[model samples]
Target: MSAVDVYLADQRAAIPGPSWTRRDLLREAGDHLEDATDAYTAAGYTPTEAEALALRDFGSVDDIAPGFRDTVAIGAARRTAVLLVLVMLPQAFLWDGGIELGASAHSAAPDSGLFHVLDIIIGYVGTAGAIGALVALAVTAIGQRWLRIGRRTARLTAAWSLATAMIVPIIGFTMLTLTGGLTVLLALSALAFMAAPFALVALSAQRTLAAC
Candidate 1:
């Protein structure tokens, strides 16, 4: 049998409940495995057969959550992604024309005093992005070697980071649709998109630690 096939077979046996079946394992684990294929490269384990081996080592579905509980545990993921977005919301407004909320602060002319707030906001965003990236990577590292998390959550976090990065430009443009780029609604949505990854990382890391 191919390594993936072997994984599928073992997943059925590994799961604690009888309701779990091969089809469910493939649906969840297959996607999770595909996302994790590059993990070994990150881990300094460059086995020519690393992808196959990783599939073979993938832990049980129950280890992650019940087979039927696919979306059930994702509440934590959502919260985690949100926190990461919050980290940089202020910076996002500063870089975008978002602060032009129809007030003196939004004036086109340069204001001596207000410039300080802009600098501070930008600095916080810079620091938050760097720190969040580092913490996410560390969690991902621990997640890969230890299936205690099934590491799928880490991939969700990775994909969230990539997707959130893509969202920044979209949000900047979307702000143009409104009267002021930084109207309250636009600001909230922008921040929501930006902080998505941190929510997944925070929740998964929490779950992984709790598993201990």
Candidate 2:
């Protein structure tokens, strides 16, 4: 490969992004390198010597790529966080004892000791998972360095938190449905709502991981 081609390839190896994104970034980098090489060649240097000097002045891949990669990662994390908030906020209003079974809201069966116990258990589990997931998203939005967290550790922690955030609500609501407090229509609606967060987060995670 030509020196410019080789240099661009090395840069591509260091950077992590979608194909189009990487192409755009590398094109800008190649333009700078070409401009530097042309300037050196006009000063009487051989093509090879000019290319070498241009690369030397351009900075190493290790020196530049991490910052760019981290920027991309942080942007993805923010988008994911925004999505989670959008999905969860409306659902929070539904978590009250009064569930909508049809056009109107209906309270759960009164004086059911089993329902009370289930509500208490589900409340604790769901709250813990929800809070953990929010904290993880907040940390990711700010970046790992803010809390001295490593990249791998951050990804793993976020993945786990996201999974729990999705699963807990589904479990809690599904159990409520099993108690026969709602009609089939409402139970299905609840299931659909609970599953959305998990599905969306999984897809977001896949995209983020592929970029990384």
Candidate 3:
């Protein structure tokens, strides 16, 4: 394309956009490319504001940095954060069973079709809340450089992970007819994951903010 479009894309990439103006990216890129010609403009890039953003989007930096450590960190952190979400995949079904059990224990006739779906919804909501809190924590930690927050969040997530790790024991216990502890282990898992959710929300917003 022309100089204007190249600069515009660079600027857009830097600031972020499902919507943005030429002026916004221009401002975000430090407005340096305003005077350059298009062909040479997109060329000779050396990790300027725009380049950093493009790099963040996964452009190759083979000869640029010693290694793509930042990018790798970005991918891992994002995926792990996503994994927190994936961890709850079966929660809905499990929770639905819980609801159905509760209803049956009380009286099956009172339970409506809606309750089955609502049971899953309740479980998924809990899982979502925990995940959301974690994202919020990550954004505050990573973007703001909170001295202790990142470490704290990492620890908490580890705890959550460890709690879930005990699930194997629960199933093993069931196999061995010793399942009482399953409830306790699951409670621990829920607690650890629920300890932080707002942080995860922040993390989810990080990419959009950094671009701007």
Best by TM-score: 2
- Please provide TM-scores, in order, for all candidate models, with all chains considered together: 0.29, 0.64, 0.29
lDDT of 1 by residue, 112-205 (tens): 4444554454455456554665556455445335545433663455455444444443433343333243556655554554434444444444
- Candidate 3, residues 78-147, lDDT tens digits: the string is 4445555554544444324543322332323224555455445544555654565367446534644644
lDDT of each: 0.47, 0.65, 0.39
For model 2, the stretches where C-alpha displacement exceeds 4 angstroms are 1-6, 13-51, 60-71, 97-118, 142-150, 181-184, 209-212
Q: What is residue 66's positional error in candidate 2, in angstroms?
A: 5.0
- Which lDDT tens digits does candidate 2 get at residues 1-212? 97889878987887665455567777888999999999999999999999999988988788868765655555555555556656655554666524544334343544667667766776676666556557657777665666754345436544654675556666666566656667666667766776666577657655555555
* Model 3 per-residue lDDT at 100: 36
Model 1 Cα shift for residue 83 (angstroms):
14
TM-score, cand. 3 = 0.29
Q: What are the root-mean-square deviations of the candidates from the true structure over C-alphas? A: 13.2, 4.4, 13.5
Top candidate by lDDT? 2
Q: Rank the candidates by lDDT, best first.
A: 2, 1, 3
- TM-score, candidate 2, is 0.64
